[model samples]
Target chain A: MRLRFRQSLDDLKEKLLVMAGMAEQAIQRAIEAYRVRDTSICDLVDRGELAINRLEREIDQMALDLLAMEQPMAIDLRFILAVIKINADLERVGDAARSISDRVRELQAFPVADLPIDIPRMASLAGSMVRKALQAFIEADAQTAETVLSMDDSVDKLNGAAHYTLLTLMKKEPNLTPQALNALMISRSLERVADHATNISEDVIFWVRGADVRHKMGEKPATEKTGTRS
Target chain B: MRLRFRQSLDDLKEKLLVMAGMAEQAIQRAIEAYRVRDTSICDLVDRGELAINRLEREIDQMALDLLAMEQPMAIDLRFILAVIKINADLERVGDAARSISDRVRELQAFPVADLPIDIPRMASLAGSMVRKALQAFIEADAQTAETVLSMDDSVDKLNGAAHYTLLTLMKKEPNLTPQALNALMISRSLERVADHATNISEDVIFWVRGADVRHKMGEKPATEKTGTRS
Candidate 1:
């Protein structure tokens, strides 16, 4: 029974890693779609949702079965709980990617306007936060998770700057409003991608330290306080 | 031991209901903040978050303790799992409220230029969804939960209309772009609140039916797809 439980735990972790990879790839493709003005890449992001959703259901069932059969105690229980929460966060990361893709598709209808925000840079930072958080989850490293938390502020600043610049662009050149609105929405989606990354890191901290540091970042924690700040 | 577990289950339900109330009230208050254009009310929405976060921690700890102690199986296990999932959704309902308040605060910075979106109407629909989903959870009524699922389309339609109108306003009036953008973000936040409500309903169905109906809505449920859509 002990050996079976350990193997199931390993299986759960593996499935989550797979889910994480799909989500990360979806975001990368979505960003690429935005950069290259390619709707076909956006279609790939949309097509990828089924596999992610299937994995979500599968992972959730696996975690549920583990809790029911294994009755894992202490760290084992925490680890499964963390996996469940991170699974939800990763699914949202996929949603954020899909949302970005939708915005990119909308952008395809309008002529490309040169916006001032560096979207690829912001997306790269958000993507790295996701990558680092997953590494922390794999290693159960609370320190690396904390590093992911600190990176959120930089993404938030970039999103804020993006928000200001996009709105200014809209006010100055009304012709660009369509593309600018799409860019603004895409920026918000990336910010939420960072938020999901922050959430994954917090879940890792909770799992490793058995501490609920979700709202411990500041007054209320940016994850819950102002998640859609762009 | 069985009696103790039953009592603990009731305790968990009551705590969740309390969390549900706070989330509902926060959304109501945030909408009121927008309706009245009052930043002070936004501050109230911000302050209430601490209690909401505390309850999230306490409820999660209670659920986890119950899971570890009771070793619940079958429907009972599903119920506890539902509680955990619902707890997360309620916290995000709180976050959605806070996000709306943030936009309301930003809206206060600009002069009140009446945009085309019927925000109060959209908010009312979203709030009703939350209330009904909680009602279904309390009663374990899958039918009521399904009704909540259907209500989501109307909210989505409302949000789509709001998005179109707001963008048109920004394009036509240029001067109203800031206010229109704020309205756009607020509409998106309400849409997410509806999504969370949809999620709660799905959890209720899963608990009662033992069927995963989350992504069963369409090709993919809007809750996990296009969640941040505006």
Candidate 2:
């Protein structure tokens, strides 16, 4: 029974990794859609959302079942609990991806304005944050998760810069407001993706070290939480 | 042991209600800060976040301890699981509140332009959604949870209209870009609160009806997810 339960925990982790992959891919594809101005990839991201949502439900159920059926030790308990929370965060990451694709599609209709924001660069940071957080989880390395936490400052800085640039662009060229507005929203979405990654890393820290570093990760990414970055 | 476990469940529920109250109060206070343009009230919202975050950790830890130590019945297990998810959602509602307060503080510095969006109306709706969803959790009434689900559509529409009005305002008055951009972010944050409320109701439904009505919640509030409501 103990061996079977161990296998079950392993299965749960494997499922989460799958969900994480789908979420990362969605973010990447959505950004690719923006880079190339392709609506077809937006459709793919939309479909990808359905799969991610389905996997989310499945993984959540598996985690709950593990807790109900198996008597896990403290460390194992924390691991399972972390899996549940991380599952939700990953699903939100998928939501962020879908929001980005939606923005990408909207900007497609308007002639692409050369907004002074590097969204793909911001997105890449958020994506790597997700990847590193998951790696921290798989390796059970609190230090690795700590690295993910520190990396969030860079993403938050990028988001702040993007927010300032886009707002300035809107003020200067009112005609570009539509595209700039969408771009701002996309930056916000990527910022949210990074926030989810930060949350995941916090959960990993909790699971591996039994130490909670939430809100302590940094002042809630002032730009992400509060509206006044200016 | 069974009686002890029952008491633990009751304890968990009561603690959640307290956390729920903190989150609900935070949302209302944040909106009031915006309504009155009071920066001091924003300080309250910020401090309130710390309390909410602390409660979240406490409740999550209690749920985990219960699961590890007690042999909860199927229904009881589901109840604990729902509480865990709801705790996370309520924390996010607090986050939305903090975001609103931040925007309010930012907006206060600018000349109050009578933006056409009805933010208080939308916030009241979102707050009531949180209230009703918690009521459903208390009563174990899936129908009450269902009402919260329907209420999300209205909030989503309000968010959509606000998005449109704000974007148009930005286009017409380039000078108002700063205020309008902040307003737009505020509306998005409230929209997220509604989304969080929607998620809590879905968790309540899962608890009471053993249903998974997620993604199936009226097409993911197109505006909240896909961003093409223009």
How does each model score on lDDT? 0.86, 0.86
Model 1: CA > 4 A from native = A211-230, B211-230
Q: B1-230 in candidate 2: lDDT tens per residue? A: 66766787899999999999999999999989988899899999999999999999999888877776645554676788899999999999999999999898888778988889888898899999999999999998889999999999998899888888988989999999999888888889988988998899888887876433333535552123122111
The DockQ-based CAPRI class assigned to model 1 is acceptable
Tell me the lDDT of model 1 at B10.
99
CAPRI-wise, candidate 2 is: acceptable
Indicate the worst ten consecutive residues by lDDT in candidate 2 chain B: B221-230
Candidate 2, after superposition: displacement of residue A37 in Å?
0.8
Cand. 2: chain B TM-score: 0.90
Misplaced by over 4 Å in model 2 are A211-230, B211-230
Q: TM-scores of the first chain across all predictions?
A: 0.90, 0.90
lDDT of 1 by residue, B1-230 (tens): 67877998999999999999999999999999999999898888898887898899788777777766745655676788889889988998899999999999888778888677799999999999999999999988999999999999999999989988988888899999999999899999999999999989998998887544432534542232122222
Model 2 lDDT, residue B20, Cα: 94
Alpha-carbon TM-score of each model against the true structure: 0.91, 0.91
After aligning candidate 1 to the native by TM-score, how far in Å is the CA of A117 from where it should be?
Answer: 0.8
Looking only at chain A, give the TM-score of model 1 against the true structure.
0.90
TM value for model 2: 0.91
